[model samples]
Target: MAAPRVSVFPSPQELGPALAQLVAERAAGGGDRFSLGLSGGSLVGLLARDLPAAITGPATTGPAAPARWLLAFCDERLVPLEHPESTAGAYQTQLLPRLPGPPPRVLTPATGLPPAAAAEEYAGQLRQAFPGDDVPVFDLLVLGVGPDGHTCSLFPDHPLLQEEDKIVAALTDSPKPPPERITFTLPVLNAARSVVFVATGGSKAQILKRILEGGEEQPLPAARVRPASGELLWFLDEAAAKELNIPVEKHSVL
Candidate 1:
Protein backbone atom coordinates (compact mmCIF):
# COMPACT_ATOMS: atom_id res chain seq x y z
CA MET A 1 0.00 0.00 0.00
CA ALA A 2 1.14 3.56 -0.70
CA ALA A 3 1.65 6.05 2.09
CA PRO A 4 -1.19 8.49 2.78
CA ARG A 5 -0.44 12.18 2.11
CA VAL A 6 -2.23 14.52 4.47
CA SER A 7 -2.54 18.27 3.75
CA VAL A 8 -3.27 20.39 6.79
CA PHE A 9 -5.14 23.66 6.38
CA PRO A 10 -5.98 26.36 8.91
CA SER A 11 -9.65 26.42 7.93
CA PRO A 12 -12.25 25.01 5.51
CA GLN A 13 -12.03 28.23 3.54
CA GLU A 14 -8.43 27.43 2.68
CA LEU A 15 -9.04 23.75 1.99
CA GLY A 16 -12.12 24.33 -0.16
CA PRO A 17 -10.39 26.63 -2.64
CA ALA A 18 -7.49 24.20 -2.94
CA LEU A 19 -9.84 21.34 -3.73
CA ALA A 20 -11.72 23.41 -6.32
CA GLN A 21 -8.49 24.32 -8.10
CA LEU A 22 -7.45 20.68 -8.20
CA VAL A 23 -10.78 19.70 -9.76
CA ALA A 24 -10.58 22.44 -12.36
CA GLU A 25 -7.09 21.33 -13.35
CA ARG A 26 -8.25 17.74 -13.73
CA ALA A 27 -11.24 18.77 -15.84
CA ALA A 28 -9.15 21.03 -18.08
CA GLY A 29 -7.41 18.05 -19.66
CA GLY A 30 -9.07 16.86 -22.91
CA GLY A 31 -11.72 14.25 -22.29
CA ASP A 32 -15.37 13.57 -23.11
CA ARG A 33 -16.22 15.06 -19.74
CA PHE A 34 -15.06 15.04 -16.16
CA SER A 35 -16.99 12.75 -13.83
CA LEU A 36 -17.13 14.01 -10.25
CA GLY A 37 -18.80 12.23 -7.37
CA LEU A 38 -19.74 14.28 -4.33
CA SER A 39 -20.62 13.53 -0.74
CA GLY A 40 -23.07 15.41 1.47
CA GLY A 41 -22.29 16.91 4.85
CA SER A 42 -20.74 20.12 6.06
CA LEU A 43 -18.30 19.36 3.25
CA VAL A 44 -20.86 20.30 0.56
CA GLY A 45 -21.33 23.78 1.99
CA LEU A 46 -17.61 24.45 1.80
CA LEU A 47 -17.53 23.11 -1.76
CA ALA A 48 -20.42 25.39 -2.69
CA ARG A 49 -18.33 28.39 -1.72
CA ASP A 50 -15.07 27.21 -3.25
CA LEU A 51 -16.19 25.68 -6.59
CA PRO A 52 -17.92 28.84 -7.84
CA ALA A 53 -14.94 30.96 -6.87
CA ALA A 54 -12.61 28.69 -8.82
CA ILE A 55 -14.75 28.22 -11.98
CA THR A 56 -16.42 31.56 -12.47
CA GLY A 57 -14.99 35.02 -13.19
CA PRO A 58 -16.19 38.66 -13.34
CA ALA A 59 -18.95 39.01 -15.95
CA THR A 60 -17.42 40.10 -19.24
CA THR A 61 -18.54 40.30 -22.88
CA GLY A 62 -18.40 36.79 -24.37
CA PRO A 63 -20.02 34.86 -27.23
CA ALA A 64 -20.60 31.72 -25.23
CA ALA A 65 -19.68 30.11 -21.87
CA PRO A 66 -17.65 26.99 -21.30
CA ALA A 67 -19.30 23.61 -21.44
CA ARG A 68 -20.75 22.42 -18.16
CA TRP A 69 -19.25 19.39 -16.46
CA LEU A 70 -21.00 16.37 -14.96
CA LEU A 71 -21.83 15.85 -11.29
CA ALA A 72 -22.94 12.60 -9.66
CA PHE A 73 -23.57 11.51 -6.13
CA CYS A 74 -21.23 8.95 -4.63
CA ASP A 75 -24.04 8.03 -2.24
CA GLU A 76 -27.61 9.19 -1.76
CA ARG A 77 -30.43 8.86 0.67
CA LEU A 78 -33.59 7.08 -0.57
CA VAL A 79 -35.67 10.22 -0.76
CA PRO A 80 -37.32 12.38 -3.41
CA LEU A 81 -35.43 15.27 -4.98
CA GLU A 82 -37.59 17.60 -2.91
CA HIS A 83 -36.93 15.74 0.33
CA PRO A 84 -35.02 17.56 3.04
CA GLU A 85 -32.30 14.90 3.23
CA SER A 86 -31.89 14.47 -0.51
CA THR A 87 -28.25 14.82 -1.48
CA ALA A 88 -29.09 16.20 -4.90
CA GLY A 89 -31.44 18.71 -3.31
CA ALA A 90 -28.67 19.91 -1.03
CA TYR A 91 -26.31 20.44 -3.97
CA GLN A 92 -29.00 22.16 -6.05
CA THR A 93 -29.73 24.51 -3.18
CA GLN A 94 -26.09 25.17 -2.36
CA LEU A 95 -23.76 24.51 -5.32
CA LEU A 96 -25.71 24.43 -8.59
CA PRO A 97 -27.19 27.92 -8.66
CA ARG A 98 -23.84 29.60 -8.10
CA LEU A 99 -22.22 27.74 -11.01
CA PRO A 100 -22.12 29.38 -14.45
CA GLY A 101 -23.92 28.08 -17.58
CA PRO A 102 -27.12 25.99 -17.71
CA PRO A 103 -26.13 23.30 -15.19
CA PRO A 104 -23.95 20.21 -15.00
CA ARG A 105 -25.51 16.89 -15.90
CA VAL A 106 -26.79 15.81 -12.50
CA LEU A 107 -27.28 12.02 -12.27
CA THR A 108 -29.66 10.77 -9.61
CA PRO A 109 -31.62 7.67 -8.69
CA ALA A 110 -35.16 6.94 -9.92
CA THR A 111 -37.36 7.98 -7.04
CA GLY A 112 -40.39 6.35 -5.32
CA LEU A 113 -39.03 2.85 -5.06
CA PRO A 114 -38.02 0.57 -2.20
CA PRO A 115 -34.42 0.78 -1.06
CA ALA A 116 -33.27 -2.33 -2.93
CA ALA A 117 -34.90 -1.31 -6.16
CA ALA A 118 -33.61 2.20 -5.86
CA ALA A 119 -30.05 0.95 -5.35
CA GLU A 120 -30.26 -1.26 -8.42
CA GLU A 121 -31.62 1.65 -10.42
CA TYR A 122 -28.71 3.82 -9.36
CA ALA A 123 -26.24 1.08 -10.24
CA GLY A 124 -27.81 0.85 -13.67
CA GLN A 125 -27.55 4.62 -14.02
CA LEU A 126 -23.82 4.44 -13.29
CA ARG A 127 -23.27 1.64 -15.77
CA GLN A 128 -25.08 3.60 -18.46
CA ALA A 129 -23.33 6.89 -17.70
CA PHE A 130 -19.93 5.23 -17.60
CA PRO A 131 -20.00 2.34 -20.02
CA GLY A 132 -16.69 0.56 -20.56
CA ASP A 133 -14.91 -2.78 -20.57
CA ASP A 134 -14.51 -2.56 -16.81
CA VAL A 135 -15.54 -0.41 -13.86
CA PRO A 136 -15.83 3.32 -14.64
CA VAL A 137 -12.96 5.48 -13.44
CA PHE A 138 -14.25 8.66 -11.86
CA ASP A 139 -12.23 11.81 -12.57
CA LEU A 140 -12.51 12.86 -8.95
CA LEU A 141 -14.44 11.89 -5.87
CA VAL A 142 -14.98 14.20 -2.88
CA LEU A 143 -15.71 12.30 0.29
CA GLY A 144 -16.50 13.03 3.93
CA VAL A 145 -15.59 10.82 6.87
CA GLY A 146 -18.12 10.28 9.61
CA PRO A 147 -16.99 10.45 13.20
CA ASP A 148 -16.91 6.65 13.09
CA GLY A 149 -14.78 6.71 9.91
CA HIS A 150 -17.55 5.93 7.45
CA THR A 151 -17.22 7.21 3.89
CA CYS A 152 -19.83 7.11 1.12
CA SER A 153 -22.23 5.70 3.72
CA LEU A 154 -20.15 2.55 4.17
CA PHE A 155 -19.92 2.13 7.91
CA PRO A 156 -17.27 0.15 9.75
CA ASP A 157 -18.15 -3.40 10.89
CA HIS A 158 -21.02 -3.59 8.37
CA PRO A 159 -21.64 -6.49 5.97
CA LEU A 160 -21.36 -4.01 3.05
CA LEU A 161 -17.62 -3.90 3.65
CA GLN A 162 -17.39 -7.47 2.36
CA GLU A 163 -19.34 -6.79 -0.84
CA GLU A 164 -17.38 -7.71 -3.97
CA ASP A 165 -19.70 -8.55 -6.84
CA LYS A 166 -21.91 -5.48 -7.08
CA ILE A 167 -20.60 -2.04 -7.87
CA VAL A 168 -23.37 -0.40 -5.81
CA ALA A 169 -25.61 -1.59 -3.04
CA ALA A 170 -28.49 -0.43 -0.87
CA LEU A 171 -27.63 0.12 2.78
CA THR A 172 -30.68 -0.58 4.88
CA ASP A 173 -29.30 -0.41 8.39
CA SER A 174 -26.72 2.36 8.56
CA PRO A 175 -25.45 3.05 12.05
CA LYS A 176 -26.28 6.68 11.48
CA PRO A 177 -29.87 7.75 11.17
CA PRO A 178 -31.83 7.82 7.86
CA PRO A 179 -30.81 4.18 7.36
CA GLU A 180 -31.83 3.74 3.74
CA ARG A 181 -29.09 4.83 1.34
CA ILE A 182 -27.43 3.83 -1.91
CA THR A 183 -23.64 3.90 -2.13
CA PHE A 184 -20.84 2.95 -4.49
CA THR A 185 -19.17 -0.28 -3.40
CA LEU A 186 -15.48 -0.52 -2.58
CA PRO A 187 -14.57 -1.81 -6.04
CA VAL A 188 -16.11 1.20 -7.76
CA LEU A 189 -14.73 3.64 -5.18
CA ASN A 190 -11.20 2.29 -5.58
CA ALA A 191 -11.50 2.66 -9.35
CA ALA A 192 -11.62 6.45 -9.20
CA ARG A 193 -8.83 8.47 -10.82
CA SER A 194 -8.55 10.57 -7.65
CA VAL A 195 -10.09 10.26 -4.20
CA VAL A 196 -10.00 13.08 -1.68
CA PHE A 197 -11.22 12.99 1.88
CA VAL A 198 -12.22 16.35 3.38
CA ALA A 199 -12.27 15.85 7.13
CA THR A 200 -12.28 18.70 9.66
CA GLY A 201 -13.23 19.51 13.25
CA GLY A 202 -11.76 18.26 16.53
CA SER A 203 -14.53 15.70 16.77
CA LYS A 204 -12.78 13.68 14.05
CA ALA A 205 -9.30 13.90 15.60
CA GLN A 206 -9.31 10.51 17.36
CA ILE A 207 -10.70 8.58 14.39
CA LEU A 208 -8.26 10.29 12.04
CA LYS A 209 -5.42 9.12 14.26
CA ARG A 210 -6.77 5.57 14.25
CA ILE A 211 -7.19 5.50 10.47
CA LEU A 212 -3.73 6.87 9.77
CA GLU A 213 -1.65 4.83 12.23
CA GLY A 214 -3.81 1.95 13.36
CA GLY A 215 -2.93 -1.56 12.17
CA GLU A 216 -4.60 -2.99 9.06
CA GLU A 217 -6.27 -5.68 11.14
CA GLN A 218 -8.11 -2.99 13.09
CA PRO A 219 -8.82 -0.97 9.94
CA LEU A 220 -11.33 1.84 9.67
CA PRO A 221 -13.50 2.33 6.57
CA ALA A 222 -11.63 5.49 5.58
CA ALA A 223 -8.38 3.51 5.75
CA ARG A 224 -9.64 1.15 3.03
CA VAL A 225 -10.17 3.88 0.40
CA ARG A 226 -7.16 3.37 -1.86
CA PRO A 227 -7.43 4.19 -5.57
CA ALA A 228 -6.10 1.69 -8.12
CA SER A 229 -3.39 3.99 -9.52
CA GLY A 230 -4.82 7.38 -8.68
CA GLU A 231 -3.85 9.87 -6.02
CA LEU A 232 -5.41 9.90 -2.55
CA LEU A 233 -5.38 13.12 -0.56
CA TRP A 234 -6.68 14.15 2.85
CA PHE A 235 -7.57 17.79 3.54
CA LEU A 236 -7.58 18.27 7.27
CA ASP A 237 -7.80 21.25 9.58
CA GLU A 238 -5.62 21.82 12.65
CA ALA A 239 -8.27 20.61 15.04
CA ALA A 240 -8.79 17.42 13.07
CA ALA A 241 -5.07 16.84 12.77
CA LYS A 242 -4.45 17.28 16.49
CA GLU A 243 -4.09 13.56 17.26
CA LEU A 244 -2.13 12.61 14.14
CA ASN A 245 1.57 12.39 14.85
CA ILE A 246 2.68 11.86 11.25
CA PRO A 247 4.21 14.78 9.42
CA VAL A 248 1.71 16.75 7.29
CA GLU A 249 2.54 19.39 4.72
CA LYS A 250 0.97 22.83 4.82
CA HIS A 251 -0.61 24.01 1.54
CA SER A 252 -0.37 27.54 0.04
CA VAL A 253 -2.34 28.71 -3.04
CA LEU A 254 -0.24 31.78 -3.83
Candidate 2:
Protein backbone atom coordinates (compact mmCIF):
# COMPACT_ATOMS: atom_id res chain seq x y z
CA MET A 1 0.00 0.00 0.00
CA ALA A 2 1.46 3.33 -1.02
CA ALA A 3 1.20 6.34 1.25
CA PRO A 4 -1.38 8.76 -0.05
CA ARG A 5 -0.41 12.47 0.15
CA VAL A 6 -2.61 14.19 2.70
CA SER A 7 -3.45 17.88 2.43
CA VAL A 8 -5.46 19.22 5.33
CA PHE A 9 -7.21 22.48 4.65
CA PRO A 10 -8.64 24.98 7.11
CA SER A 11 -12.01 24.91 5.37
CA PRO A 12 -13.85 23.24 2.50
CA GLN A 13 -13.98 26.59 0.73
CA GLU A 14 -10.19 26.70 0.49
CA LEU A 15 -9.81 23.01 -0.26
CA GLY A 16 -11.74 23.16 -3.53
CA PRO A 17 -9.47 25.57 -5.39
CA ALA A 18 -6.37 23.76 -4.23
CA LEU A 19 -7.80 20.49 -5.50
CA ALA A 20 -8.83 22.09 -8.76
CA GLN A 21 -5.32 23.55 -9.15
CA LEU A 22 -3.77 20.13 -8.57
CA VAL A 23 -6.11 18.70 -11.18
CA ALA A 24 -5.30 21.51 -13.60
CA GLU A 25 -1.57 20.94 -13.20
CA ARG A 26 -1.94 17.23 -13.82
CA ALA A 27 -4.09 17.90 -16.88
CA ALA A 28 -1.45 20.32 -18.18
CA GLY A 29 1.15 17.53 -18.24
CA GLY A 30 0.43 16.78 -21.93
CA GLY A 31 -2.34 14.52 -23.07
CA ASP A 32 -4.96 14.95 -25.73
CA ARG A 33 -7.39 12.87 -23.73
CA PHE A 34 -7.80 14.24 -20.22
CA SER A 35 -10.08 11.65 -18.69
CA LEU A 36 -11.80 12.68 -15.45
CA GLY A 37 -14.31 10.84 -13.29
CA LEU A 38 -16.54 12.88 -11.00
CA SER A 39 -18.42 11.88 -7.90
CA GLY A 40 -21.47 13.56 -6.39
CA GLY A 41 -22.40 15.21 -3.05
CA SER A 42 -20.69 18.34 -1.68
CA LEU A 43 -17.90 17.60 -4.09
CA VAL A 44 -20.15 18.76 -6.89
CA GLY A 45 -21.09 21.83 -4.90
CA LEU A 46 -17.50 22.57 -3.97
CA LEU A 47 -16.26 22.24 -7.52
CA ALA A 48 -19.12 24.40 -8.65
CA ARG A 49 -17.82 27.08 -6.31
CA ASP A 50 -14.13 27.08 -7.19
CA LEU A 51 -13.24 24.86 -10.16
CA PRO A 52 -14.19 27.55 -12.65
CA ALA A 53 -11.65 29.92 -11.14
CA ALA A 54 -8.98 27.32 -11.86
CA ILE A 55 -10.20 26.65 -15.41
CA THR A 56 -10.04 30.10 -16.91
CA GLY A 57 -7.25 31.81 -18.95
CA PRO A 58 -3.87 30.05 -18.73
CA ALA A 59 -5.14 26.63 -17.63
CA THR A 60 -7.03 25.93 -20.85
CA THR A 61 -4.50 27.63 -23.17
CA GLY A 62 -1.79 25.12 -22.34
CA PRO A 63 -0.79 21.97 -24.25
CA ALA A 64 -3.38 19.91 -22.33
CA ALA A 65 -6.66 19.74 -24.14
CA PRO A 66 -9.06 20.59 -21.35
CA ALA A 67 -11.66 21.22 -23.99
CA ARG A 68 -11.46 17.65 -25.23
CA TRP A 69 -11.50 16.22 -21.71
CA LEU A 70 -13.53 13.08 -21.24
CA LEU A 71 -15.90 13.64 -18.34
CA ALA A 72 -17.84 10.82 -16.69
CA PHE A 73 -19.13 9.88 -13.30
CA CYS A 74 -17.43 7.60 -10.86
CA ASP A 75 -21.00 6.53 -10.10
CA GLU A 76 -24.37 7.90 -11.12
CA ARG A 77 -27.94 7.34 -10.05
CA LEU A 78 -30.38 5.50 -12.29
CA VAL A 79 -32.68 8.42 -13.06
CA PRO A 80 -33.39 10.91 -15.77
CA LEU A 81 -30.54 13.35 -16.39
CA GLU A 82 -32.93 16.18 -15.50
CA HIS A 83 -33.54 14.85 -12.03
CA PRO A 84 -32.07 16.89 -9.16
CA GLU A 85 -30.45 13.78 -7.74
CA SER A 86 -28.79 12.80 -10.98
CA THR A 87 -24.99 13.05 -10.88
CA ALA A 88 -24.81 13.93 -14.52
CA GLY A 89 -27.40 16.62 -14.04
CA ALA A 90 -25.46 18.18 -11.20
CA TYR A 91 -22.24 18.38 -13.19
CA GLN A 92 -23.97 19.68 -16.29
CA THR A 93 -25.66 22.43 -14.36
CA GLN A 94 -22.94 23.24 -11.90
CA LEU A 95 -19.54 22.42 -13.34
CA LEU A 96 -20.03 23.13 -17.05
CA PRO A 97 -20.32 26.89 -16.64
CA ARG A 98 -16.79 27.06 -15.25
CA LEU A 99 -14.98 25.71 -18.29
CA PRO A 100 -13.18 28.37 -20.30
CA GLY A 101 -13.37 26.74 -23.73
CA PRO A 102 -15.15 23.91 -25.51
CA PRO A 103 -16.72 21.38 -23.23
CA PRO A 104 -15.35 17.90 -22.65
CA ARG A 105 -17.07 14.92 -24.22
CA VAL A 106 -19.43 13.66 -21.57
CA LEU A 107 -20.37 9.97 -21.15
CA THR A 108 -23.31 8.93 -19.07
CA PRO A 109 -25.22 5.73 -18.46
CA ALA A 110 -28.44 5.17 -20.37
CA THR A 111 -30.74 6.00 -17.51
CA GLY A 112 -33.88 4.70 -19.22
CA LEU A 113 -32.69 1.09 -19.11
CA PRO A 114 -32.86 -1.44 -16.32
CA PRO A 115 -30.08 -1.26 -13.75
CA ALA A 116 -28.12 -4.24 -15.09
CA ALA A 117 -28.61 -3.13 -18.68
CA ALA A 118 -27.64 0.43 -17.83
CA ALA A 119 -24.38 -0.79 -16.39
CA GLU A 120 -23.60 -2.72 -19.55
CA GLU A 121 -24.43 0.25 -21.73
CA TYR A 122 -22.09 2.43 -19.70
CA ALA A 123 -19.36 -0.18 -20.07
CA GLY A 124 -19.90 -0.13 -23.81
CA GLN A 125 -19.59 3.65 -23.83
CA LEU A 126 -16.24 3.33 -22.08
CA ARG A 127 -15.06 0.68 -24.53
CA GLN A 128 -16.01 2.88 -27.46
CA ALA A 129 -14.20 5.89 -26.00
CA PHE A 130 -11.08 3.96 -25.06
CA PRO A 131 -9.48 1.78 -27.72
CA GLY A 132 -8.17 -1.82 -27.41
CA ASP A 133 -11.03 -2.88 -25.08
CA ASP A 134 -8.90 -3.03 -21.96
CA VAL A 135 -9.97 -1.46 -18.64
CA PRO A 136 -10.14 2.31 -19.03
CA VAL A 137 -7.49 4.21 -17.13
CA PHE A 138 -8.84 7.64 -16.34
CA ASP A 139 -6.22 10.41 -16.30
CA LEU A 140 -7.73 11.67 -13.07
CA LEU A 141 -10.58 10.65 -10.85
CA VAL A 142 -12.10 13.10 -8.33
CA LEU A 143 -13.94 11.08 -5.72
CA GLY A 144 -15.86 11.50 -2.47
CA VAL A 145 -15.95 9.28 0.58
CA GLY A 146 -19.22 8.50 2.32
CA PRO A 147 -19.35 8.36 6.09
CA ASP A 148 -20.09 4.67 5.68
CA GLY A 149 -16.78 4.27 3.87
CA HIS A 150 -18.10 3.90 0.35
CA THR A 151 -16.73 5.43 -2.83
CA CYS A 152 -18.54 5.76 -6.13
CA SER A 153 -21.65 3.59 -5.64
CA LEU A 154 -19.82 0.72 -4.00
CA PHE A 155 -21.22 0.53 -0.48
CA PRO A 156 -19.61 -1.30 2.39
CA ASP A 157 -20.11 -5.08 2.24
CA HIS A 158 -21.90 -4.87 -1.11
CA PRO A 159 -21.38 -7.68 -3.60
CA LEU A 160 -20.36 -5.16 -6.25
CA LEU A 161 -17.23 -4.39 -4.27
CA GLN A 162 -15.82 -7.75 -5.32
CA GLU A 163 -16.61 -7.16 -8.99
CA GLU A 164 -13.53 -8.12 -11.02
CA ASP A 165 -14.48 -8.90 -14.59
CA LYS A 166 -16.63 -5.91 -15.42
CA ILE A 167 -15.49 -2.33 -15.81
CA VAL A 168 -18.88 -1.10 -14.72
CA ALA A 169 -21.66 -2.70 -12.65
CA ALA A 170 -25.16 -1.92 -11.47
CA LEU A 171 -26.29 -1.62 -7.88
CA THR A 172 -30.00 -2.06 -7.33
CA ASP A 173 -29.96 -1.74 -3.58
CA SER A 174 -27.56 1.03 -2.67
CA PRO A 175 -27.50 1.77 1.04
CA LYS A 176 -28.04 5.39 0.01
CA PRO A 177 -31.11 6.90 -1.62
CA PRO A 178 -32.62 6.18 -5.08
CA PRO A 179 -31.62 2.52 -4.72
CA GLU A 180 -30.23 1.84 -8.19
CA ARG A 181 -27.04 3.20 -9.79
CA ILE A 182 -24.28 2.47 -12.26
CA THR A 183 -20.69 2.68 -11.02
CA PHE A 184 -17.14 2.10 -12.18
CA THR A 185 -15.80 -1.13 -10.70
CA LEU A 186 -12.53 -1.44 -8.79
CA PRO A 187 -10.73 -2.60 -11.92
CA VAL A 188 -11.50 0.62 -13.72
CA LEU A 189 -11.07 2.91 -10.72
CA ASN A 190 -7.77 1.42 -9.59
CA ALA A 191 -6.44 1.73 -13.11
CA ALA A 192 -6.69 5.53 -13.01
CA ARG A 193 -3.46 7.53 -13.40
CA SER A 194 -4.35 9.57 -10.34
CA VAL A 195 -7.17 9.73 -7.78
CA VAL A 196 -8.06 12.44 -5.30
CA PHE A 197 -10.49 11.91 -2.46
CA VAL A 198 -12.13 15.12 -1.27
CA ALA A 199 -13.69 14.62 2.12
CA THR A 200 -15.10 17.23 4.49
CA GLY A 201 -17.01 17.55 7.77
CA GLY A 202 -16.65 15.91 11.15
CA SER A 203 -19.02 13.15 10.09
CA LYS A 204 -16.17 11.74 8.01
CA ALA A 205 -13.52 11.94 10.72
CA GLN A 206 -13.67 8.40 12.08
CA ILE A 207 -13.41 6.67 8.75
CA LEU A 208 -10.66 9.04 7.64
CA LYS A 209 -8.69 7.90 10.63
CA ARG A 210 -9.18 4.25 9.78
CA ILE A 211 -8.44 4.77 6.09
CA LEU A 212 -5.39 7.00 6.53
CA GLU A 213 -4.10 4.98 9.42
CA GLY A 214 -4.87 1.23 9.19
CA GLY A 215 -6.05 -1.85 11.10
CA GLU A 216 -9.51 -2.86 10.22
CA GLU A 217 -10.53 -6.53 10.10
CA GLN A 218 -12.16 -5.80 6.77
CA PRO A 219 -11.12 -2.78 4.75
CA LEU A 220 -13.77 -0.24 3.81
CA PRO A 221 -14.58 0.27 0.16
CA ALA A 222 -13.01 3.75 0.15
CA ALA A 223 -9.79 2.31 1.63
CA ARG A 224 -9.63 -0.28 -1.16
CA VAL A 225 -9.23 2.43 -3.81
CA ARG A 226 -5.52 2.00 -4.49
CA PRO A 227 -4.21 2.91 -7.95
CA ALA A 228 -1.97 0.20 -9.43
CA SER A 229 0.82 2.59 -10.48
CA GLY A 230 -0.20 6.17 -9.83
CA GLU A 231 -0.70 8.86 -7.26
CA LEU A 232 -3.52 8.86 -4.72
CA LEU A 233 -4.24 12.05 -2.79
CA TRP A 234 -6.57 12.86 0.05
CA PHE A 235 -7.69 16.48 0.32
CA LEU A 236 -9.20 16.86 3.73
CA ASP A 237 -10.89 19.72 5.50
CA GLU A 238 -9.96 20.20 9.16
CA ALA A 239 -13.18 18.64 10.38
CA ALA A 240 -12.58 15.52 8.33
CA ALA A 241 -8.95 15.11 9.41
CA LYS A 242 -9.63 15.71 13.12
CA GLU A 243 -9.13 12.14 14.25
CA LEU A 244 -5.74 11.79 12.62
CA ASN A 245 -2.46 13.03 14.06
CA ILE A 246 -2.05 15.38 11.09
CA PRO A 247 -1.18 18.96 11.95
CA VAL A 248 -3.80 21.62 12.39
CA GLU A 249 -4.80 23.33 9.18
CA LYS A 250 -3.49 26.42 7.49
CA HIS A 251 -4.59 26.92 3.88
CA SER A 252 -2.05 26.04 1.18
CA VAL A 253 -2.38 25.07 -2.47
CA LEU A 254 -0.71 21.91 -3.74
Best by TM-score: 2
Candidate 2 stretches with Cα past 4 Å from truth are 246-254
Candidate 2 C-alpha RMSD relative to the actual structure: 1.9
**lDDT of each residue in 1-254, candidate 2, tens digit only:** 46788889988878988988887777777767688899998888888888777767776676544686888898989999899989998988888867778887999779999999999999999999998959998989999998889999998889988899999999889989999999999998899889999999999999999887877988999989999998888999888888897544456544
**Per-residue lDDT for 209 in model 1?**
92
Please give the TM-score that candidate 2 achieves against the real structure. Answer: 0.95
In candidate 1, how many clashes are counted? 0
List clash counts for every candidate, in order. 0, 0
Pairs with backbone N, CA or C atoms under 3 Å apart (clashes), candidate 1: none
**Candidate 2 clashing pairs, residues 3+ apart or interchain:** none
What TM-score would every model get versus the actual structure?
0.92, 0.95
